[model samples]
Target: MSAARIFAVMVKEFTQLTRDRLTYALILVMPIVQLLLFGYAINNDPHHLPTAVLIQDDSAFARSTLGAIAHTDYFDIVETARTPAELTQAMARGRVQFTITIPGDFTRRVVRGDRAQILVEADASDPSATGAAVAALAGLPQEALKRDLLGAVAPARAAAPPFEVVVHRRYNPEAIAAYNIVPGLLGVILSMTLVMMTALGVTREYERGTMESLLATPVKPIEVMIGKLAPYVLVGLIQTVVILALARVLFDVPMAGGWGVLSVGTMLFIVGSLALGFLLSTVARTQLQAMQMSVFYILPSILLSGFMFPFRGMPDWAQWIGTIIPVTHFLRVVRGALLKGLGFADLWQSLGALSLFVVVVVSLAMARYRTTLD
Candidate 1:
């Protein structure tokens, strides 16, 4: 508790921190990055989501309902389908996020003073988007019904007839929280494990002088990188399998898509996350520093990646920042595949973004490692 001793310790700590260029850069860069990401990208309310209408009735009443939805500014009609099969195909292909179906007897039912049925199907894999779509659909028919009721009813003590709202919440139709959360848990688990593991892997070798000894051998940097990465890649796969099994067995989360696509997407996500960790490791001189840097990167990823909060609710700036993190795209791919039964054609954008992340992060890590090796 001596003042002199405390001052000396403080000085030593400052000297160590100053000598570590990576720690210094992280301290400087992390705040700005996190501020921008938190302030701009996170949004809970989303508008103008792409929607489709399948009008089998195609009558005045059907057109009125469609016009009401379209004019609300909540949805943009991207396509129209005349048949139910065609509408199903569009939903399966992820061409439309929300679908509206007006039964063939809609106009006749309304005219006959009977309740008409409208089927609203939403991709509930993304809860925020699904909720917004459902809310819009729920209100649309009610408003139309109210307007029609007012016109048909007597001015004195008019009573509204009973109507039914049929909401088909597709893919987690029950709005199971586990179905939404479990798939994302896989991404979060892998992000934490892979990034921290790989971040420490290279830095620990350098700190212990093993990296130099390895470099002295015939192994090239690329080979060393691959060798270092191979084991963790397997670890990532193991984690994926474990999580998938738990999700299915314990949580009853359905795997509607092919296992092959999930496997490939998981591997790609692991590679990208591992590369990002390796990049951090190349810059970090100590294992402790590497761990801190990994945390710094991971914190923002968890917050902004639509893991805990809804991505659609986030502001544009926050959403943009979330997009930069590999976890964001990975979550989309995993959840979309696992819950929505979506295929590569539907998730090409996320897949492509993950690929880009892998390339850029791995290249940066290699470049930095090369400089460190030389």
Candidate 2:
């Protein structure tokens, strides 16, 4: 090819690309998103995990051990109570990431050179998130007693304290990856299919050159938008039932919560995802761009919504970004229901966030849809 002809083609291509401002901006923005995700947000070795303590003994050894746990960056004690039920409720609501229980006989056992157990319960829904923090527990009591028991009678000052840590991984007790992944799969699968399917709606109509004829008919923009959305919403719900059944039968992932709660949450999530797709469809001028935009939105949800990583593991800013994603809240609903046996009251904030997402996205789509063929 001649140099002059190559230069002319380059100019024409750049001109076309520049005219598509959304694509142009996204192209620039994705690299920055990547930079933030890699450099600042994505830490494989997570620390300072939220922890709750159940200290039934209120003994000196227990106090010393709790202080030691606080010193380590592995856990941050945010709540303390005397009952297991209280802490379990906190875990069910996702208010706390871990629970440490000091048994009433801890001091007596340690003094007598008996193996005293410190019960540490972890929310192991995402195993990777808890793996590091749990691993850090191996040498805790020994290290704590070495410092705490300088003048104590006998066994308390022994080289290794008679105390041992007993770890209980809650939810996914076996640490089975499938049990965790399957529940999150509900969110991931729904997000991928539902968003992409509806994202193609208006772009499909535009590409087929049927927009003019459709606008010529006596249909309001709101009605036309609803018509485009209704069928996909049904498809989403149908997929939800199929997936939930398969997860139960094939994977044996437990549905610990009520059927009614799961049904309501699935409906809210599907509608929100559909609204998101409709919003994307309104913004994108072509089907390819619609797919691109949806993918842009989808990638961060998968990475930051506590699917691939622990929700508590992510940095504060990344977690803040995740809160805006409907998939993030929806995953909490699914996981809490399926694994923790949580009910509506424990899960209302997440459901409310999803409803708010639908309202905002639907409102934007309504504003963006034009009655004219253009």
Candidate 3:
């Protein structure tokens, strides 16, 4: 390329970028915003998780154990449950994240030099939160037992079995972060690339006056939409396969669920993303504006979709905002399937949400799309 040609192209590109205020703002502001949000707002550590106590044995030993747990700042005793059924109900309603059920015979068994069993039930929907809570609880009884055992036996024997801590990492036994994040990134990557590509694709045709020529042909609106979406759907599938393969080979991430299920889930996500792009294209007057709209949509999808940050860590308002993004639902489905090996029964809500989004967005785009530019 000649120097003059390169300079002209550069000038055109800079002018295009300058014309799109949203894209310019996103390019300048998104990185800083993401850094601040992810650095300060996202914490993997779970603290002061709400917990219910069912202390049937209200003795010195039970009280001591409860005190130890409470003093550690890990468990906030929100309420007292009278029965296991009540505890279960509380957990199901998400009123309590964990429940400590100290059996009626807890003190009697401990005092009699017999083993005492305390049942701990934790909601593991948010794996990071559940893991931290479980770890804190696991150390409690052991510390209490150590204190008691040391007083009984001088310098505690070398082979002493003080108290057994059985930790059942619910939902995910291994507690792998990649198992959650990798699948979620699939949705994020697809939404970011596919939406931008499609949005710009139609807008570019409009900028070049090619859309008019194309519409003058026999192609119907729906047919045009289909033809435009088809190639990007294939691209989305290719990206999915590459991501899955990389996750498996490089990250040792297991495909715990069937590929068929993943394929369908990914297709739904792509449809939603493409529909969003098409909608943006209908409103955007130029390719630069289309790109800007894509960026405006993508930033929230990345930040709020739980791709780079833990969803539970975000504030209630932020989480509610996240619920509106198509990528958020897609992430839930992908992560649930890939990590938890969740079936259709487990992921039906997410899939249903994506389906609804696709319908709404595509319908709006079709309605807005005019064959004749007025």
Candidate 4:
């Protein structure tokens, strides 16, 4: 109603906003971070995807065909497998996205026009990452042997394709998006709820004038931290069960691996998330700041953690940053356990990473709590 009063209130509010350094930084920094992540880091049509090759044939045609495949800029041959078992292990462990197997008599069969086959196996769990690479293969059979089919094999080149590209889409053979997304939701949901909830719960004590009473108590910092986080851990696990249940019943996502591995990984991630929340509470002066800090963490986790985009699709720097986030490792564990039928050996690195995150974050939260006391 009063123009002068309205102007005064607006000035006061702007001053208050600038004084809240965390919120001010969030406002200024979040947009820049989002722009960089989306512009530079995110790539749906990923190139140089890791590939493994098993060349049973040592002939010129085999070599020529592989040379053509490599030049596509889609598949990067990172490993050479001696046997089928090794190739299987590579895919199982998420080492390679595509595998090429040139049969023992590929050259002989191609020269004789006997419909020689080159086996191409792809990890189709995350279809978006593999789609372009797989599509690149369709043209390879027609174009790969064009040069080698000269002279005696000239007739071979003209007879349809010199070789067949037999593609086997591993894991989610149907390339169902739900297979990738549903399992990832467990990590995302747990990270969102557990971190925000734990941060708010502790910050609420300070807001409600209970923190002074808590400080007056005889309980130690570690004891208080554990007490605050324990309830949220249970809540996270319950959310995990509910999400997994809906994933199976609604989406029909496969639970391929053992429950034991999923259980251990889930617990580690939930605990780590709660520890991170506690750490944020130590840094944030109010519930709003705690919530903002949580968003700062959650946004990158959703983007760079391969929840929404392909992890391998991101640039090396983004991937490196992603590895430091617990959600990235948790997503791997969940997807491996649920979709790939991955065992402890296949998932050890991710599990170990999650374990390390829990230890480091909990230790940092404890240290931050000590600082809060001071």
Candidate 5:
């Protein structure tokens, strides 16, 4: 109850905090990470989404329309697809958010006052990302051909409109939030649970003095790491099954892709997450420190991984950082396989990224793991 006793206790706590360098660093670093992510990385209104154009008409009018759409800062026509198959592959692979098909006779039809339609196909898997961009398309019909519809085509502009912009929202056409969220939740949940559980389980061994027995065993470091993580892999798979089942039954989330692709992706992500957790266990001295480290890792995984925010909406630098996190690639795999029916050919890069993450994390964990009781 005394003032002197209270002051002494506070001084002791400050000393203890300073001694625990990892905890002290987390205290300062966590807030900065949160601030940077929210302030710079997280953007609801993403612009310049990658778009592909199947320009069958090599006319001045078609180019003018594209120029007008690009001027809005909503779509960036990155690819020129020669055929419908090319455009379909791009969308399936998560390469482009939108595809515009300008028919060969579009300019001819527009000048004749006949029906001319510009097909705008959007990958609406994550509807929030597509909503603003789709909304921007409304005015393109009125403004797109303003300059091109001059001279002989002047009367066409004054009519109903020069050409029709037929917006087809592909995959989750209804803009259902649950369709996007449920699949992403699988990654977020696995990242949180697998990482935290593995870190804590290993750290617990040290606290209970069981780590000495583990050190006494002549098992190789890689062997020990794999042995410890093997059980958690099963746990992760079980969780994935449960979540996906609920997603199908309750949320009606479509599983458009093959089970084989999803299975490979799920296994890769689970092992990668457990490997990261093992890495955290090596750095943290106590169970509490391990838990704190897991949270630090999970925060960025949830935010930068596109689990909660629009991935393409993030600035270039932020997107670069997001690419380094495993969950970012895994989310693509899950969402792609389930929603778009993307095959191995379409998702090879993401699968490769997950494999690289597992290798890097497991190597780091092996190097950090202590060989002796000392």
Candidate 6:
């Protein structure tokens, strides 16, 4: 190519970019924002994980053990569980990430200089979140005993500590990466397909000039939006079944939860995804712009949805940003249901949030829809 022709093309592209300030801003500023979000937000070594305690013993030693876990930033003891059911419920609700079950005889065994066991139930459905926190527990007693053993009648300082921390990694005993990733793929895939499909569907109507004809037929905006979105629910179901089947057959991923529960949650998430696509369609004048916006949304879906990394590994601010993302909530629903056998009681929070997303996005799409035929 001639140097003069190359320069002319470059100048023409710059002029076009200047005319489209929004696209230019996204090109320049999006990368910087994405870097800050991914760099400062993501943390492989998650800390201060919300935790609950099941105290079986009322003894001083047991109290000391609780304090020691709470003292570290690795575990944030949110509440005390009165029974095993409460702890399980907490796990299902995503209220607590871990459960520290101090057996009833723990204090007695420790005082008697016998081997005592403390069970730490970790929701290892996402192994990365628990890996560092579980590894940090090895020296927990050493930290606890530093205060307790000031003048203890128990085992001396040089002797082996009488307690053993038993970490029971629930749902993912082997810590297989596939077990975590397989379920997450459902949400990621659903978001990508549902959003892009609906966005392209509506944009294609604009490209074909059928939108003006439809708008002239007295069809309400909400009705048109609903009509465009309804077919995608069936499509989402087919995709969900295929992905789940592949996960079970190829990766041996377990589906401990009820099918009914998983189906309902998946439906809500799918509806939300389609609603978002409808919203994006109203903002995009062309199919190409719709595709670009879908890609922009996909970035957050992959990065902030706990698919590429641990959800809790990110800083609190990033997590708050993640909270508003529909895919993030769907990931929790899928993982909790398939891995933990979580029922409505445990998954209602995410399901509710996803439902709200559908409502809000559909409302926005309805409001943004242009009823006038051009």
- 1-374 per-residue lDDT for model 4 (tens digits): 99999999999999999998889998998899889876899999989999999999988888888898999999899999999999999998999999999999998899899989999999999999999988988888888877777886799878878889999999999999999999999999999999998888768887887878888878788899888888887888789989999999999999996578889999999999999999898878899999999998998999999999999998999999999989999999999999998878789999999999999999988877752345
TM-score of candidate 1 to 2 decimals: 0.83
Q: Which scores better on lDDT, 3 or 4? A: 4
C-alpha local distance difference test of each model = 0.79, 0.85, 0.75, 0.90, 0.91, 0.86
- Sorted on lDDT, highest at the top, how do the candidates line up? 5, 4, 6, 2, 1, 3
Candidate 1 Cα lDDT to native: 0.79
Off by over 4 Å in 5: none
- What is the per-residue lDDT of model 3 for residues 263-330, given as tens digits with 9 covering 90 to 100? 67789889879878988998887787788778878877887776766565566667687888888888
Clashes of 2: 0
Which portions of model 4 miss their true places by more than 4 Å? Answer: 371-373
Q: Give, for candidate 2, the lowest lDDT window spanning 10 residues.
A: 150-159
Question: Which digits, one per residue and each the tens of the lDDT, describe model 1 over residues 107-185?
Answer: 6766655776788788777666667656766566556655544455423113233234588888878788789889999
lDDT of 2 at 242: 92
Best by TM-score: 4
- Cα lDDT tens digits for candidate 6, 250-330: 999999966777888898889889989989988887787788889889998899888988888888899999999899988
TM-score, each model? 0.83, 0.93, 0.72, 0.97, 0.96, 0.94
Candidate 3 residue runs with Cα over 4 Å from true position? 1-41, 48-107, 113-135, 142-165, 258-261
For residues 1-374, what per-residue lDDT tens digits would candidate 2 score against the true structure? 69999999999999999998878888998889877774677777789999999998888788888888888899999998668899888787888889999999988888776788889999988788889888888878768776555555554565465688999999899888877888898898899998999999898888898987888999998898788889988898888889889999999998887566777888988888988898899888899899998888888888888887777778898889889888899898898888888889888998889889888998999999888865
Question: How much is the lDDT of residue 219 in candidate 6?
Answer: 87
Model 5 Cα lDDT, one tens digit per residue, 219-314? 777888888999999999999999999999999999996577788989999999999999898888999999998998888888888888899999
* Candidate 5 TM-score, true structure as reference: 0.96
Better of 1 and 2 by lDDT: 2
Question: What local lDDT score does residue 120 receive in model 2, on the 0 to 100 scale?
Answer: 91
